[model samples]
Target: MSKIVYFFCFFFCFGIAQAQDDLLKELDSDSIAKSQITAAAFKGLQICTMQSTKLASKGEWYFLVAHRFGDLTEGFDNFFGFDNALTKIGGLYGVTNWLTVGLSRHTLNKNYELTAKYKLANQEEQGFPVTIVGYNTMDINTKLSTDEFPELKGTDRMAFSTQLLISRKITTGFSMEIVPIYIHKNLYEPLSEEVDNFLLAGGGRYKISKRISINAEYALRLNANDSSFYHNPATIGLDIETGGHIFQLVFSNSQAMNDVSYFTNANGISDGKGIYFGFNLYRVF
Candidate 1:
């Protein structure tokens, strides 16, 4: 009888211990699963002038406004280039958690653009160490005149851009990204013989506070047909987040906002001589 009671007690304790161990293992698995879904590698939809690997939550709406003044060295006679500023107004909508669509109009070249972004992979999720996203944009030049070239068709005014955005969050406060971009223009400038352009863009962000960050970006053309007329675009900026809005203040050597125009048509270098002051405001709803 004594042996039977001892055996029963031992079995009961063993069962209890086994159950507790199983419960702990389940909880640990849940913790790791949650950790795999990373958040906020970048604060806003853009790192500076290029798109980031962030997409809006489902059903969210975003309003965007951007401006670029003329060359800051234009002197006080032009009010520091504020008198010749160009503006871009646009809106973005989240179709899903991983997809966004946008449309915008820019004063430069009277350009109209439609854009789409899709998230492909996320960092620290399912053994992935980096995030990847795909971007596509179509631009139309409304300012082109048929009188200049009677043979020009409507399609001649169209341009397209495609980019692959890859990024990593190295630390809690620092992040970086690389973009491989291809731009196609139906109408090339008279000086250039190529209709296609390839560029490599890089950007980085460092958080100074919860609400502010220092940002910079540069786009380098891989194949330049004319070096004198086209230069790589570089921008440095500050990102300020307040409530549901993001405000960006920057200095850049490019005047056009769209990829095709800025990447191919930029006439300024990163040097101070042709840099222009610019700002972007984003509001979320």
Candidate 2:
């Protein structure tokens, strides 16, 4: 009995250690992603996009909670888990308003991912006009042995990710990226062909006032078959800002936010075009 108890304890500790190691790896990826957000690819000198502002308010903490509802295509409920939802939790720091760093973890039905970003521009009270940074994501739940995950059998069986981003503030509330690299895991049954996944995306913000803005982004797949257009995963979002938080309403063809889940795991519309309406909530101190 004593020996058995000792063995169990050792196994438990080993599992915990593995979990921590994975967490650390994700944090490192977040660091790279945040750098891209504020200085490299998807940022602007203004507070028009979803990221926190770069206006420097030292010693402040912020929190953001978001949910995205996944809908079913008409008459496809019997063949898919079409009525579920995904959630994301994130937070940030205002180490001077002009700089912000944050992390977000997205939880899907059976997938998980983490994202991190940092800011390198000051749009509200500006000094320069370039938004520079880097961004990366780690896919923790996109790959597994078929024996362990029987449901994923005959799938492409792989992990996925993307990186390297830098954007510029074109106008007071407008910005764009310099073509960030795209990553995709080849994970489909009848559609297991590798794709030309390179895509281009850019977004902008128009401040109607100090607390309201319009934001949107679109990307088209570089090399893909005709049927793949139904799953290209483009999105548009609207921002409603209050004193210390933001609420976003969005429309997208893709229901997943994890890079792997979004890119390689999309369930295409079998009967017709599938569209979804979702929203996100962002908060900070």
Clash pairs (backbone) in predicted model 1: none
Instruction: Quickly count the clashes in candidate 2.
Output: 36
- Which 10-residue window in model 1 sums to the lowest lDDT? 11-20
- Candidate 1 deviant stretches above 4 angstroms: 1-35, 270-272
lDDT against true structure, model 1: 0.82
For residue 227, model 2's alpha carbon misses the true position, in angstroms, by 5.9
Count of clashes in candidate 1:
0
The local distance difference test score of each candidate is 0.82, 0.50
Best by TM-score: 1
Give the deviation of candidate 2 from the true structure as CA RMSD: 13.6
TM-scores across all candidates? 0.86, 0.60
Q: After best superposition, candidate 2 residue 176: deviation in angstroms?
A: 3.8
| Model 2 CA lDDT for position 55 | 31
